[model samples]
Target: MGRLLSKEDVLAYAIASTALSTGGGGVGPSLESVAKMYDDAIAKGARPELIELSEVPDDAIVTSVVATGGGVSPEMMMRWGGRGGRLRRDLPFGRFDPEYIRDKILENDATWCPLNSWSKIPGPDFRRKAWERLKELIGGKEIFSRLFFEISPFVTRDLCYMSLEGMKAIDATCAGYRAAPEISQSGLNLADVKCTPAVITTVWGDLLILEEVLCFQRAEEIVEGIATYSGGVAGGPFALTGKEAKKGMIPGCISFTIDIGKAILKARESGDDIAEAIVDASKGRAFKLFEGKIAEYWQEPKYSFIWGMVKIKGTGKYAGHRFKAWYKNEFHISWLDDKPYVTSPDGINVIDPKTGWGLANFWPAEWEPGREVVVIGVKNDERWETPRGLKLFGPQHFFFDIEHVPIDKIYKNFE
Candidate 1:
């Protein structure tokens, strides 16, 4: 029999899950959203059960719902909103705006000669037509491709919003699944019983689609497919975020997220320091790396992820020391005084030093300058540190050529 999920348990799971979602850096679902899910479940006499993946039969089917994508700048959102939130397709030259093209050249330091003429084109509409005419005159097929690349930020922001919607849809679908007669009839035994097994996840903003549901001979195969297909740890694997993926499946991941959230709330109520409380509650699996104010930050939409960096000036006992963190959707690497301190597969988080509230990757706009924060690092499952896991989520996977180092080794001096 599975453990019945109480209202409090649901809230706890959400809090922890949210922490896990951003690698403990940002907020996940609001408390109200979590509460609503629990309330609805209770009302429908649908009790969510918590069970270990090992307990399930080998023949069961399972699926994972993982979040992807990264933060979008407010500037991009406003720019698209002003254009009615629809991507402009009427391109004589393409979607490249004059200012956008100029910025691209400047960003690249004018290595490309053709972009230098961008400023000569007057007005957005005129610039598009002029670029088109120039491309035709020069017989440059690559010109349009370059133009699209320059304007990709806008398209990325639009996709970010769409991906967010997909996350919500998954959540709703999971709720529906839990309340269905099949789940109840199966006595909440996800495995052994014949019913669809779905694992809904929360993480960065990225979109994934399953053209059709495919069956597997074993449940573990399904878990592996989801983790690999979704890009594994860096891509959105549960193990990379501290949730266990066994035989490729995570049994109590949803409940686990809620449990972490509850622990945070309990610690806060007890008047304990939030970071310390989280560490203690996790049995020392989570720890604070540094506490300070954000000194510098930068982010841009790249490909399908938000590439960014954050700099922090340490405060209190750690004052005078500087720290830096680089992120792709989630924090992937951190440096202390220019030395690699922690890398991906290990959770990196920025939280309120006082309240322990996790800060989102895209929150620099509203976070203000010099806002106090504490950087937290939580150890991930050993499985994530393996050869195959590293390939999918290691520093090299994120475009960094550095070798993978365990968090414990990097922070050994601190201990």
Candidate 2:
């Protein structure tokens, strides 16, 4: 007979698989990123440890981590599988430059879990929907005693939901929530996988459903469905655990393909392979569903030596790539772009406060990382960069530094 498979075994296998691909870089003793996540989990008071997969009970609750397109996604990324072209209508690829392109590439391949695999997904909600439909085949009252649950690691980033009180609740519900899955995502390095018990409710289900529905190809449909029900935000849905609206995780029943597996019972005349069905149900369906969405905005990443970087935005140390937008702040000064505004050792200078034009051969943000006095803004020639706006000797006299100027001060002119 084949060995009995447990939820813990599946999780362990995934970690092992990723490690093989990373060539021993994941969850290793020296991996700081992985370690930090563990430490953070412990500090939060959840006993997250790593251990052999064999330790998990057959009935213990397990949550799967789904990750995909690690960061912001371009229009093309949304259209996966054979249907990509048909669905490709107008995908948004925001402002592009050297830095922007590099960010997009890294975002796609960054070490992730749950949704993204070493290469591909389960085929367009393929894994999830398949499981839900499978239920039709195996109706109630006959087999398994518990419910199947799944989740994505990315949603854990919701600071509001992952509160101290929240973890305690989760820990209390489940005998023990495993801590080794995304050890890198945690602050602890030493992982001693632990498992006890876990429980979930529709409250959890509602949250997962909303998050994914919005990110799916049929977002509009999901939103409409959510509108029919209560406990939603003005424009989005949230975890249903009596929390505020969070359109992060959407949960629901997905359809499955029947032909993939034989009857639930292959032994008895009036029965099927009840044992196999129990095992299969305990795990997920041949197919799985993933309901998630990418955010509309991402933060503009600042790079420096301390960040272990150089030559970015087509200049600096790592040049050649065009500077582009990975995530644009609601507002940013296009004048400076990705280039650092450096300053010299000399004291600050200013043109006219009313005229916001001044220039310095150097900017402060460009200097090496160290405690150094930085002159705010300085001016030299007719064309200079100044925090007090700029004064151009030329006729056009362009001024775009409105950002630095105070709202009230803008109407007044200073000598």
Candidate 3:
């Protein structure tokens, strides 16, 4: 039977999903706003629901919804390479192309540009227009379920928003626990499920539909390029059948995110360790990676991605040691005392020690120096352990030469 979620459930999911989002998934003040939207939405009669993949009929249609463009705020980007702080001009994804950025987005009278900080970013209702456009294309086909493109507060909010339109949330995601930098990182690619007939929409009212894609790689380039120029977007591909959803999604993640949130809330109420609560919620699949104070942080916007790194000075048992992590919207690589540690497809979360909130990399202020944090490693979905999955998500895929190591094995080795 499908389960109907209460307002509290979604509130919890919003908070907990941030921790699971690695370093991305719309954390910080944005997450606070998402939580409020949930309460407000539910108060106005929205009843979000979740169902297992098995509950969907073979003919049931599943629609994927997502927003692109997660780079640091224009305010932060404006501060780059100024005064004492410095940021890398590029990484293996390729060098930052200023001329290309200028020609594509700035010259088009974009609200936010290198010279101006007035960001015309997407709003909470960003998807409404896109959804309407998609509805027009799909005709009268009732959407059986809404699939999460990734884990984040936005995902839960999208769930509630769709429920208001009568679509249930699928207890699954295209990516695993953490967010990915590319659309091609989705399990849909691994399962050979196509995501064409995709709809890409921007806040400025521009809409484009992809009747077909040559491959996942081409789709990523096309969608990301458009999003890059449009200053972020909403809308995604649809036409996933129940059988295809079962094959292309990582299931049970919604409940798992809620469980983690519930654990944290219970711990806070009982005056227990929030970090320990997270570990317990994962049923031992998560482990405390470090307890530390932010020692240094650096970030810059590149190609609609917030690429950055953070250094943490250890405390307590980890005293005298240091840890560092690198991210492209989400943390993808880490090192303990400068030795290679956990990498992508696994999670590396920097969380508030007391509140258990994820300190998002997308928002640079969250990682300011002196903030105390607890870093944790949660296991990725089992599907990511395969060769194809590794090829798509591992450290090497991000141009890092390090091998992908499972969280448990990394912890065991550290011990």
Q: Identify the candidate with maximal lDDT.
A: 3
The digit string of per-residue lDDT tens for model 2 on 1-415 reads 1132222322222222221111111111212332344446546654422222333334432232211111112332332101111122122332222244334335545533223344332222223342243333334212111111111121122211233333211211010111111111111101112110111111112223322322221342333233223111102111111111011111121101011112221222345432233224423311110011111211211110001111113222213322211111101111123432221111121111111111111111221222111111211111123321122111112122332322122211111
Instruction: Give the worst 10-residue stretch by lDDT in candidate 1.
Output: 144-153
Q: Is candidate 1 or candidate 2 better by TM-score?
A: 1
Cα lDDT listed for each candidate: 0.46, 0.21, 0.75
List model 1 lDDT by residue over 273-338, tens digit each: 777777676665576788788899877653234567889998886788889998765677888998
Strongest candidate by TM-score: 3
lDDT of 3 by residue, 1-415 (tens): 6798876677678778878888887643344565677777788778778888678898888776434565534543342211122232112221123333434445445444344365553444554666666777778677776778777866766666767777778888788777777887888889999777778775444567888778776887777666665554334656678888888888888888989988988887899999989998898779899989999999877566778899999988888999999998889999999999888888899999898888877567567799999999988888898999998898878899898888888873234
TM-scores, one per candidate:
0.58, 0.19, 0.84
Give candidate 2's error at residue 357 in angstroms: 33
TM-score for candidate 1, residues paired by index? 0.58
TM-score rank order: 3, 1, 2
| Better candidate by TM-score, 2 or 3 | 3
Report the poorest 10 consecutive residues by lDDT, candidate 2: 171-180
Give the distance in Å from residue 71's predicted Cα in candidate 2 to where it truly belongs.
Answer: 15
